[model samples]
Target: MRWERGRRSRNLEDRRAQGAGRRTGRLRLPLPAGRGGKLSLTSLLIMVGLYFLIGPEALQGLGGLGGGGLPGGAQVGLPGGGSGDVASGPLRTTPAEDELVEFVSFVLDDAQQTWARLLPGYREAKLVLYRDTTRSACGVGQAQMGPFYCPGDEKVYVDLSFYGELRSRFGAPGDFAQAYVLAHELGHHVQHLTGTEARVRRAQRSSPGDANELSVAMELQADCLAGVWGHAAAQRGILERGDVEEGLRAAGAIGDDRIQGMAGRAVQPESFTHGSSAQRQQWLGRGLDSGDPAACDSL
Candidate 1:
């Protein structure tokens, strides 16, 4: 992807230097690697709920959420502090961090700009970059929770190191794959603007038993929306050979089914919130093929 010279987004909130010892300081979740070396499904579900329903404040209350300072101890809202610090950090990047940030900003700008132009009554959303732990309108967002969009705040929070996991453990390595992740989060923003997220939350509350399925549908729609952006990006002559393949790999890598399978359990369809790998690929493919946002409304 030819993203280096693209427009950088002004919506990026750099909270990397806020320092540690926060007000209600909560623990960070473990990364996809390390001692336990596995993503916790239960914790992630809790995070998803906090991110979308309760808010970040709820994260601090989770009993098992633990970890010392992030390698850099950069607090959220402090631009480029903890997660962006280069010296002695837990998830330090090897010179590519700036490049990754630039790439992320560019894609964000593209997606939001697209929405602003195409969607009626669209409001721009901010992207927050932080390290191990940070405070958000939703509650305390832990880096271990992976990237999530907090609808309450209308902001997307990401721990940059997750990109490394995207390349390594997730088996989806490429610039476009990273873009897909950002686009997926932005898709949540789109949902917020369109009231889809609110409807999903209402449905989840009204029917507790179907919450996971509803969540999966919402996530799958986001994947499709990401694909729609991919299609637009391709038409702009930025997509290279195999870029689509990289994106598909990413959509599959983070699927709830794949994550659960990696955790050594039988794939329980009812427990899935992000859809299966095949479903992700299918919806993403639909978006990529059509490039129309309306075509992405699979739910």
Candidate 2:
């Protein structure tokens, strides 16, 4: 994406180096101490059975990993070692990081501007970049949970290292991919501002069995919003020839099915909080093709 000359948002918050505090210490997991300590076939079968029964959450606990004892930690699936061991801190980003930040800020400005012009009483949302954990209106925010928007605070939180995963592991490399991620989170902010997020969350509680489906709709709508931003960027001459493809790739890379597959499992549609790869691509394409926010009603 041609983003350098674009407008940067003032809502970008850099808290990369603020570790909250140093980790207690190196966490040493227990391993069986014996000759030929390979797990028994019976044990393996039982573990597999548990995996099939309880899902990825069981797998993480069985492995004795996770930062904050949750899945998708630095040890489990993160690109960089999640420690943010920068001499100057993760907030003291490099020129390349700065470029990415600037690009995201510009896209955020574009998306918020679009919303402001299109939606009544639209308020700009703050996007925060932090390392490890940070306090938010939605309790402690972890980088492992990836980027998220807190509806209560009307803020978006991200850890830039995730952009590395978006590139290396997810195979969605490019500046535009990063922008798409930012725009998606901000799209959640849009949902919050429009009261869509709260209504969905409330409905999720009442309809517990279909909670995941509601979340999928919410996520897909965000993808559509991101696509809308992509279209706007194109009209503004900020998008390059392959930029839309980059965003589409990103939308696919983070699909619930692809993520579940990477974590070693079958694609369980009912369990998906985010939509499937095809659904995400479809929504993104819908917005890209139409460039209309009104067309993003996945509900």
Which candidate has the top score in lDDT? 1
Error of 2 at 163 (Å): 0.2
For each candidate, what is the lDDT?
A: 0.72, 0.70
Q: Which stretches of candidate 2 lie over 4 Å from their true place?
A: 5-8, 20-72, 75-91
Stretch of 10 with least lDDT, candidate 2: 59-68
Error of 1 at 193 (Å): 0.4
Model 1 TM-score is 0.77
Cα misplacement distance, residue 179 of candidate 2 (Å): 0.9
lDDT of each residue in 141-192, candidate 2, tens digit only: 6556677777777888876667776787778998788888888887787788
lDDT of 1 by residue, 1-299 (tens): 88756345689997744533231223533344324655577666665654554354464212110111122322233223232323222433334666777888998988887777768888999989876567777676766576788887888888776777667667889999989988888888888888998888888789988877777788888888888888888988989999999999988887777777666668788877777889999999999999888887767
TM-score for each of the candidates: 0.77, 0.78
